[model samples]
Target: MIDQEDVAALLGTEGPFARELPNFAPRAAQQSMARAVQHAITERETLIAEAGTGTGKTFAYLVPALLSGERVIVSTGTKALQDQLYFRDLPRVRSVLDARLKMALLKGRSNYLCLYRLDQTVREGATFDRTQASQLATIRTWSARTRRGDRAELAEVPEESPLWPRVTSTPENCLGVECPFYDDCHVIKARREAQEADLVVVNHHLLFADLALKQEGFGEILPGASAFILDEAHQIPELAGQFFSQSISARQLTDLAQDSLSECNGVTGAIGLVLEPVEAMQDAVRRLRLAMDALPERGPFHQLEAKREIGDALHDLREVLAALTDVLASQAERSRGFANAHERAALISERLDRIAERDSERDVRWYELFPRGFALHATPLDLAAPLRAMREQTQAAWIYTSATLSVSSSFDHFARQLGLEDPQTLQVESPFDYAKQALCYLPSGLPDPSARDYTDRVIEAVLPVLHASHGRAFLLFTSHRALRRAAELLQERVPWPLFVQGSAPRHRLLEEFRHSGHGVLLGAASFWEGVDVAGEALSVVVIDKLPFASPDDPVLQARLEALEQSGINPFMGWQVPSAVIALKQGAGRLIRDVHDRGVLVLCDPRLTTKGYGRLFLNSLPAMPRTKELANVQAFFDDEVSAPA
Candidate 1:
């Protein structure tokens, strides 16, 4: 068994990792983090671990997890990271330790191919464009030979292809044991394997879905785990809010209508009764979407109901959904499909009533519009109590680790958010010599981020630094509008190849940027973190503004109001700390590896002008601060002339 002492030795310079792996330099912070994780797992207690960049945090937790002789569920922030951990990091550690343990990777059901759905699609002979038909054909061929049925295995199909919905299953549509393909169901197989595995890798979506018992037909996987190690754990609070919230979407309504019609093909006379109500529900959904066109993209539900046309449209939708539910209920006995449709309709109707007509002090009633759809949500203002309850119910060690979990070097905000009361905590700083490896450049005399000319002036300021670094820089913005403006402004001014976020897929854009070696990449929200560009490929990172959540956001607005009602300064208590964490994530992009040398430019004048800005600066890794443009140019010059 791997004890606390063994945890340190195993990661030591002369240990198995050093002998078996290449370029395995021992990091004290990594070893310390491993020991803390091992201790937490052994005691079965909750731990909040903050492992900074270059801390080898992945290996730190993995070493202890693989050797703990316990069933572990490791949840990552995204599917990409989940894959990297399972396929890349886990194998390396398992091989080095020679630990005999079964491991499996499980994703949300949408990621897996539903054999029954595919068969139905093929039999129904649904009309499709030539491109979709070709994609369907390709999926058909791949499904036959694939073991996992994970859509990720087939690269020929784009992730956003509409055909995927037809081929994959959702909890509502999956027929469970009654499914003809139950024995060959990919999602079931994945969960079964996860149940038997000693270690399971899942993204936050799957983890929360299972915890909420939202993924029906499968036994709960989280409660059975001996330990839950949530990496990129900072995302949990927001994700937990989403999972715990009640939501109804236009897509769900459309799916229910379409699925009811699809089921009619199996039962004689079913189409006669189901078709009209289903079509009516579809039309009602369209009408609601159109009515919402006059509203903002997103706002409080009261604002939505305030408009007479929107209120009427919502009423029509509720009535049509109720009509469909009754129609499906009348036809429920004919077939299993009808029964499922009936259940889905009744549930959706109930949800629609709750979201549209109900009021709750605990929940934020909000509506958001998409291009052709909308979602009504009732998100809870307080997740702490429920999160605490879930943690206690599992009786498992909970390990939450992230580089940016703390603000101003304190975990109070994070702990309170999750209802963690005095849990064990660890903050292992980065092993990198930040003072020597990087520079923090706060550009002088910049307008407030709210100024109309802020983005323009930010571009004007960053151009010289980009030239100094020979165009290898990331200009990250807090909003899409700023990113677009910066992209347009930089196109004519910069001579380097430009890689804008929306111009290509993120992966493709990052690939092109890395290959360009001197490319200037402009991006927004998604680019703030989870991007790794080591070496000279990225030497400058310019953040256009502080990443404060917009007060205009309905959820944030509600939560802030609640805080104010309770006599807390919402801006200091909630907004500032959250923004500090976000800024840390953005600044972290500059120095990813120990050898990486770069300059981080903060164009938001608030960093120096605002009192709370000190918290953001203090939270970042200690590095030299400068306001002179010459200093940035000289830093790059020193890097270029340094020893090879």
Candidate 2:
């Protein structure tokens, strides 16, 4: 077992060996995290840690984790963090520690190219378009010399390019180890490395996929590891819910039909001409779209009652696809190529049938209508059962840490939802002087979130802070509607350049915001947590309201019904705590570093009106609070005047 004192000393060292390493400054929270990880590994106990921002928790766990001399698997909430550890931090630590440790980064199969698909596409000469044809030529040329065949190397190719599916393999389509190119497969090689490595880095989706036995090539990720570290662990519950539940979409059916037709030469064959069925499916989809489009805008589809016709059309389409599957299955013995096509068609048919069957559920089912296209999705009523099963099966030490996991010093809310029983929990406050560094302003006289003038009041209250800070702010909202309203109001009043979420990709928008110097970014949901912008660039964060899911939402309603049936109070048990965790995520974005300073402006009056408001406020970092706008301006003025 590793000694905590020795681990702390190693992390604090600033010698020649540690110069290039990301500085691991020891804060109170970092030391606490180190001790927790050490105790868990030695005692074989489960731990839930809530380390605030600026704690340097990554290095805290990494140090003791490396010293344990045990196989460790670190799972992060996002792909960006997974890449950061595998590419940047791991190498730096390995060099200084000089511990001959083997490490590998294992991503889902979608990240690698499939040689068989590439070969088939090359032989058949199915060019997507002129642009895609050129890109495919480049990929084919590069595939010969490539060792890993990782798709990330094709940087010039756009993500939405058609050639992607042609070159990559999905779980339903892959031939697995039986393929002739099995020895040369990049995915297999990566998995082989993971099985033997001392440490492995993966994301939450891949981790949960492994737990549920849904991963494509390899079975599980953590069977070899003695301990599992989950960073940004807040996302695990929702991801686990998704992996545990079953879902199928109309797009899958369309893709299957298209792929089946692509493999055939003409209108007749041993598999019969799939062209007629494909055309019929396409026609049904077009009719379904027209029926939905005919409905009034902005109302629930279920309210129309006319939606049953659309469902009937879907039923007819499923029957046609099923017939295609039967025809394809009967010819599987004739040719290997036909057999593969038939299997894909059959899976697609079954999935669509399931979707059609689920249309009657009380949960919110809606079609996402975009400029040129749309898709349908359905979420399960509750995710607790599957998540609980996953936790019970783990024999290794399980560590769940995030900057925002608890609300008001109680883990009961999130813990109960996750089915965690009596796990060790900790909530480490930020070491910064929040009273002197920031202000939490709740403007009076603002209309309720439901009122038409709410957006106007929010902008008027926040505009002064932005001007005082000289355009360094983050205007966060719970919905896109409010974001758009605020953006419009701000553009009419403020002179600084503004950045909206979808105007550019998230990474580019952040880069532009950081570099612009005069920046105000407006975003929803995703900007709440896992965002680190220290220093003067982000001096203020304005939240529109305490984020609460729409009461009419199908998933939330279903979960409520499930709870009610079991004789539980859904509000105290579900809604309130869920909102508290989400509010914590939004509020935690303020102070990223000890040197960083900012103001958090919450325009929602519910924090003062509702009895549950105190729970939300107490859950935030113990920042100084106020209702006066002048005090906020005065605080920023003082911060600006203070010596750097």
Using lDDT, give the best candidate's number.
1
What are the TM-scores, per candidate, against the unseen true structure?
A: 0.98, 0.90
Q: Best TM-score goes to which candidate?
A: 1
Cα-based lDDT for every prediction: 0.91, 0.76
Which 10-residue span in candidate 2 carries the lowest summed lDDT? Answer: 296-305
Q: Compute the lDDT of residue 285 as modeled in candidate 1.
A: 93
Off by over 4 Å in 1: 214-219
Tens digits of per-residue lDDT, candidate 2, 211-255, equal 788334445745657788999988876786567655555566667
lDDT score, candidate 1: 0.91
- Evaluate candidate 1 by giving its C-alpha RMSD to the native, one decimal: 1.4
User: Which residue pairs show backbone clashes in model 2?
Assistant: 363-554, 364-554
